[model samples]
Target: MLVDSHCHLDHLDLSDYQNSLDRLLDTARQRGVTQFLSVGVDLPSSSRLVELAQTRDDMLVSVGVHPLQRESPPLPEVTELLSLGSQPGVVAIGETGLDNYYDKDNAEWQEQSFISHLQAGAQLRKPVIVHTREARAQTMAILRDYASTSSGGVIHCFTENWDMAKAAMDLNFMISFSGIITFRNASALREVVKKVPLENMLVETDAPWLAPVPYRGKQNEPKYVVEVAKAVAEIKGVGWQQVAEVTTANFQRLFLP
Candidate 1:
């Protein structure tokens, strides 16, 4: 079965009616995604992830702040994150990192918070779900500073050039392509995905956000990760099964710790 390495299943407006998680999970499972990584962007959401994970063995979780949170920088102690990390399905330490694209004014805060999460991940020995946007050099520097060579993480929603991809890989980080890889204008990113080693590659939807081609401009969800897998397979000239197995194994090794 495939694994969705990152998805914001809790946010994204799953309000009163139609598209319930039951249906979404069933669709994903039917499409070969049996496991999921539900990422938490803040305290309330992190608590929700813990609660969500408690209900299912297949659901794993990551806890941290989105770089833009005005919530005093999510400086939760290592002990607190470790306490949560010790729980049954808490697998990773972030949806955290630099987001210079979104919150330019808070760049300093973002840098500081990113370091804190990296340290927590280092101490807890959990793979961090790193998010870098328009700040590749800074992101790499901080990661290299705080993260040991052994404690690598995933570059989630990777849309950068192969040079950036190579740099992340050099630090032992995996590059995860999200649904954006399927877009027509994402040709450059598709090329990057092709050059990346399958052994250090993964796929995600960054769901509740960048849905793939046919589904772009709408709400995204985890199940669409298969479409990303399909795009990556075509780019890499590999079979869909190979993408499934390799990325799933990458997920297990990194997030499962």
Candidate 2:
């Protein structure tokens, strides 16, 4: 079975998510996508994600502040994050990292928040759920700064180059491709996917955004992760089943590590 290593199951409109979740799972199951990780973008939603995990064994969660949110975060300290990480069904500590694509001016804050998250993941010995966009230099540097920490994490929604992917992997990070990789226009990303080794790779949907090729222009969901796996398999000239098994195993190793 395949595992969608990253997705925003809570961000989609409640009714829409509710309407489609079951069918989405059914479709994914038929398509060989058996498990998924529901990512969290901020504190409140992170809490909600944890709640969902309590009821759904197949679902897991990550907690952190999304780079896009301007609200000053509350911290009882980084221990709060470690405490959350210790909870059952909660596997990682991000959607953290940086995103200069949205607001370049917020770079400083994003870096600070991202570091706290890394340190927290270190403390908990949990892998991280990282997000980096247009800030590859800073992201890699920060990751290096904290390299001595926990095992490592995945660069979720990876859209960067081979060099960047190599750097992250050197630091022990996994490169996760989302639906964007399936787009006809994302040749560069597909090229990177081709070069990345399957043992250090993962697949995600990043739902509610970047639906795959045939499903482009519509909302994304976990079920579409199969499209990502298919695209990766095609790019790497490997069988689709091979990509599924390796990435799913990588997911379990990272989060369940």
Candidate 3:
């Protein structure tokens, strides 16, 4: 089985599936993507995901305010995060971290929110689901300071260098590769994939976005995670089933424990 470790099910264009989440998930299951982590970008979305996961044994959820959510006033406080994060079926603390690529102006706010999520994760003993971009150095520093090694986490949709990957892994975090790795211009990212050990790796589609090649430009879905896994297998010089087995094992170890 394969797991799409990061996806926005609520944001998906489910029209093709008759606007049904169940139909969408059935398609993914048919493609061997049997598990999903529907990440949240804000409080309302987190609440929705929690509700969605409650009845689905194949689904898990993460609660947090994404760093780019400038509209979320007053930043995210540890108390607020703890309250939502403590819910059952909520296996992780964030789709949180710094993202300077899109909005460098909100760096301070992002850092504060990131720290709060890390604090909540540390307190709750749940792993974090980090979404970092152009702010690698700061992201690493904040994680090193606020994140607990025992709680751990995964650097979702990783597109950084080996140094950052090594640093995150050293902190007991897994590095997840998204469908971006399958793009023709992502040769550099594929190189990074080659160096990352399968034991510390995970695969995701980040669906409703970043659909893998052959499905690029189309609305992404959890079903496309198989393509991401196939890409990883090619980059790692391993069989596709082996990549699926290892990544599924890694996901269970980090999120299902």
Candidate 4:
């Protein structure tokens, strides 16, 4: 079975599913998507995600603020994040890291928030779900400083070059590709996928966004993660079964205790 290693279930546009999250998830299960990590973008969203996970056996959660919340309040203290992350069904810390691509003006605040999240993951002994955009170097540096095998994580929705992928792998972090890699212009990212070992790679939909080809320009769901996995297998010159089996295992290894 395949796991959607990262997604925002709380944020998905469920109008098409009769406004039913269960109907949406059931559709994904029919497509072989067995588990989901419904990511949180802030303290309030984290609380809501934890509640959502508790209602479904197949769902888990990650707590922490996203890097591009410029209009949002400053991140809570590390203690507060730890308190939230340690809650039941909360398996990871973050959808957090530096995103210079859009929020460059608040880079310092983002870095501070990222460090606190890294520390929280270490303290909780849970993996993190990082989101790095145009700030790869700084992101990696902070990760190297705070994260280790015991508190390792995955770089979700990875769109960087092989050098960055290699660097993140060296730090015991897995590289996860979203539906973006299925785009026609993502040949460079596909090349990165070829160079990275399948054992250290994962797949996500980043849903309600970045839907894979054939489904691009539409609302994404966990079922679409299969498309991302198919793309990865194609890039790595392997079968879809191998991508499904390995990436599912990779998700379990990182977020399942």
The C-alpha RMSD of each candidate to the native structure, in angstroms, is 1.7, 1.8, 0.8, 0.9
Residue 21 of model 2: what lDDT? 66
Off by over 4 Å in 3: none
Model 3 CA lDDT for position 125: 95
lDDT of 4 by residue, 1-257 (tens): 99998999998888888999999999999999999999998888999999878788999999999988766766668998999998999999998999888878888889899989988889999998899999988988898888857768999999999999999999889999999888889889889989999999999999878889999888988999999989888888899989999999988888885
Compare candidates 3 and 4 on lDDT and give the better one.
3
**lDDT of all predictions:** 0.84, 0.84, 0.92, 0.90
lDDT of 3: 0.92
Clashes of each: 1, 0, 0, 0
By the lDDT metric, which is better: model 1 or model 4? 4
Q: What is the lDDT of residue 74 in candidate 2?
A: 51
Q: What lDDT tens digits, residue by residue, belong to model 1 across residues 1-257?
A: 78999998787565533657777677788888998888988767887889888988778899888887876554656666666766678888888888877789988878877887888888878888899999989998898789756878999999888998998899889999899888888889888988998889988877789889888888887779889898899988999889999999988888765
The candidate 4 region of ten consecutive residues with least summed lDDT is 68-77
lDDT of 2 by residue, 50-73 (tens): 988898868888887888878754
Estimate candidate 2's alpha-carbon lDDT, on a 0 to 1 scale: 0.84
